[model samples]
Target: SSVSVVICSGDSVFLEGAYQYSAGTYFDTLTGGNNCDSIITTILTFASSDSSLTAASICFGDSMLLQGAYQTTAGSYVDSFSNAGGCDSVVTTNLTVSSQLSVQLSSDTTIVTGGSVVLVASGGASYLWSTGDTGSSVTVSPTSTTTYWVNVSDSLGCLGTGQVTVTVLPAEYLVYVPNVLSLSSVNLEHTRLYVYGRGVESLELIIYDRWGKKVYESSDASATTRSDGQCCAYGIGWDGTYKETGKPLNSAVFVYKLTGLFSNGKEFIESGNITLIK
Candidate 1:
C-alpha cells in the first residue's frame, strides 16, 4: 500500500486522497507496490486589486486621486468603463499636466463711482489693466464714464480676461436773483436818465416828456442789488443829460420806465415819474 498525490489547476495537493487520475496533475504509486508516477502543469491568470474601483465626477480646476490596484501615470485620461449592471466602473485612469488659469472681476457692477478693483486668477499670474497698468489690483480715477478690463497670463502661457464699468457724475449749482424794481422821475433838469436793476441780465431805460415825447433813452446803466438782509432795496443811478449834448437841460417833470431781461429769458418792465429842480 503506497501513498498518491494529485494537484488541480489553482489548487494544492498532498498524499492523502485515494489513488485516482483526474482532469488535473496527479501522482501515483503502482508497479508491484514499488514504482511511482508524477505530473505537473502551470496555469496563468490575471485579476485587479479592486473590482469595485470607479470613476469620479468633479468640477473644473479640481483634482482627484484614481484608486486602483495599478498605479496611475501621466498621460491623457479617459474613462473606459461602461454603464453595466446599473453601476459605474473605472477601467483605466490617465493624467495630463496643464497650467490652467482663469480670471474674474472683483465687481460684477460695471458702473461704479470711484474706487479700486481686484482681478484674480485661478493660478497666480501677472495682470495687465486696460490702461496699460500691471498689478493684481488697480486704482483708477476715471474723469468720465469708462470701461475697464484686465488681461491675465500664467507662467505656462494660459490667458484669461475680465472687465468692469465705471461712471462719473457732473457737478452743478443753482443761480438766483431776488427782486428787481424800477423808479420814475419827472421835471428833471435833463430829459434822459438811466438806472440799473438787481440781478438784471439785460436792462433798457427810456424817458418821456409831459407831451409824451421821447426825450431820453439809454441801453447801458449802473445797477446794484443787496443780496443779504431784509429792508435792503436794489437801485440804479442815472445822470440827467441829453445824448446830443453834455449840457444839462431845463428843469421839468418827466416819465421814466425800465425794462430788464432775466437769465431765464423772461422780460420785466417798470414805470414812474420824477421832478427835476433846475
Candidate 2:
C-alpha cells in the first residue's frame, strides 16, 4: 500500500526521506514507494519599520502633541511610541522654551498741550504699566512733565519693560515785524508797518523827532486780535506829519519806541532810530 501527501500554497511542509534536500527547491520520494511528493515552505516576512516622526520646528512656549499638532504653554506630549512587539520607537521632538515679551509706546514721541499720553504693548498678551494701567493700552495724564515706564507680559508670563520721556515746555509768546525801521530814509507819509505778537494786553507807540520833540504818540492803542485766541497789540499807518498840526515835519533823524504789556503782567520794550528823507 502507498500513502500520498500534498501541500497547499503559502503552507510549509517538511518530509523525511532517504534523499538529501537542498535549501532551494526540493522534490523527494518516500522510502519503498513508487509515488513522489513535493514540499514547499514560505520565506520569512520582514516589513520596514515606520520612519521616526518629529516636529519640524517650534517657537518658544509651544508644545507638540502625539499627532504632530502643536499647542501653547502646556499640553499632553508623546516622546516615544511603543509598538506591538514591545519595542519603543524614538520621537525626537523639541520643546521651545523662552522668556520674552515686547513693549512699546503708542506714540514714541508726542506733542500735547497738557493732556494725556497713550502707551501700548506689542507682541504680548497682557500689559502692566507702572502708572497702574492694566489694559493693552493706557492713558496717563501727569500733572507735570515726566518719564513713564511700562511693563508687558506674554501668555507664558514672560515680562519686558519700555520707557518714554514726556516734555512740557513753558508757554511762550512770539512777536514779529514785517520790516525793520530805516533811519536813513523814513517815508512817514505813506509807510504802513505791521506788528504781530501774542498775549498782549496793551501797546504804547511813541515817535520823537531829531530835536527830541514828541511828534506822534498812541497810548493804550486799540490792537487787533489774532486767530490763535491771542490779542495783537499793534499800531499801523503813519503820515509824514506832526500830530500837533497837519504840517509836514522836517526830514531828520527820529526815534521810535514800542512797549507791549502781556496778560501775565510782563512787559516788553523795543526801540529803533530812523531818518526821514524828504
Candidate 3:
C-alpha cells in the first residue's frame, strides 16, 4: 500500500505505524488482518511558512497601523496569518514614536500708520503666514489694527498654529507753542513767535490784547527748515506788534488762539497765553 500526505512545517503526521516529522519517502512494516507482515510506503511533503521583519515610525500623538491594530508607542509587534500555501505567515514590526513638535510665534507689536513690522516664527521646519508668505520671517504693513496667524510644519508633516496681533496707531500731528517772545533779543529767530511742529496743512494764528482786541495775526503755514535741511510743517508765529498799525506793542501778557487743519484731515484748536518781552 502507498500513501501521500502534506503537512505544515514543524508539524508531524502518523504514517503506516511510525510517525513522520520531515518531508521524504518512508517505508514501514504493518500487520494486516491476515497476520502476515505487509510493507507500506508513505510520501510526505511540507507547505513552507514565511516570516518577515519591518521598521516604521510615526510622530507623537499619532497612531500607526500595524497589522490589524493601531500602535501609539514604540515597541515590537508580531502578527501571524495563513499564506497562499496554507502555512502560517508571521510578520514582525519595530515601531518608533517620535517626540512632539513645538512652535512659537512672534510677540504682538505696535506700529504707526504706513509703517511695517517684521514677524518671526521658531521651532519649525517650515512656516507659512496669513499674508501668503512662506519663510521663518515675514514683513507686514497693515493699515489698521490686525491679527496675523502662522502655520508651522515639522519634517514629519506635523502641523502647529500660532497667532499675533498688531496695533496700528493713526498718523497724527503735534504742535508746540511758545509761552514767551523776546522781541528785543539779539537773535532774530527768538524775536518772532512761531508755531513749531510737523504735519500741519493749514494754520491761522491770532493774538489778542488784555482788552480782548485782535493784535497780530498771520496765515503762514509753510514749514520751517530743520538743521539737517529737512522741512517740517510750521507756521510763522506771533510777533510783538499790532496788526492795524505796523508798530511794536508794549511788553504785556496776551491771549492767543490757534486753529489748524492737519495733513490727515484732522482739525485742532488751541488757546494759550503768551508774554511779549520788549
lDDT of each: 0.48, 0.56, 0.82
lDDT string for model 1 (154-252, tens) is 775557678776543332211112222122334331222334233345666677778887766766534333333322222333445554355564567
In candidate 2, position 129 carries an lDDT of 74
Q: Point to the candidate with the largest lDDT.
A: 3
Model 2 TM-score, all chains together: 0.31
User: What is candidate 2's CA lDDT for residue 63?
Assistant: 49
Question: Top model by TM-score, which number?
Answer: 3
Per-residue lDDT tens digits for candidate 2, residues 85-197, read 43455565544546445555654432334666666667677777777877877777665567777777776666677887654333454343433343244543125343566
Give TM per candidate: 0.26, 0.31, 0.53
Worst 10 residues of 3 by lDDT: 226-235
lDDT per residue for candidate 3 within 30-77, as digits (tens), equals 888999989888889999899999888888888977768888999999
Worst 10 residues of 2 by lDDT: 42-51
The RMSD of every model to the true structure, in order and in angstroms, is 24.8, 19.6, 16.8
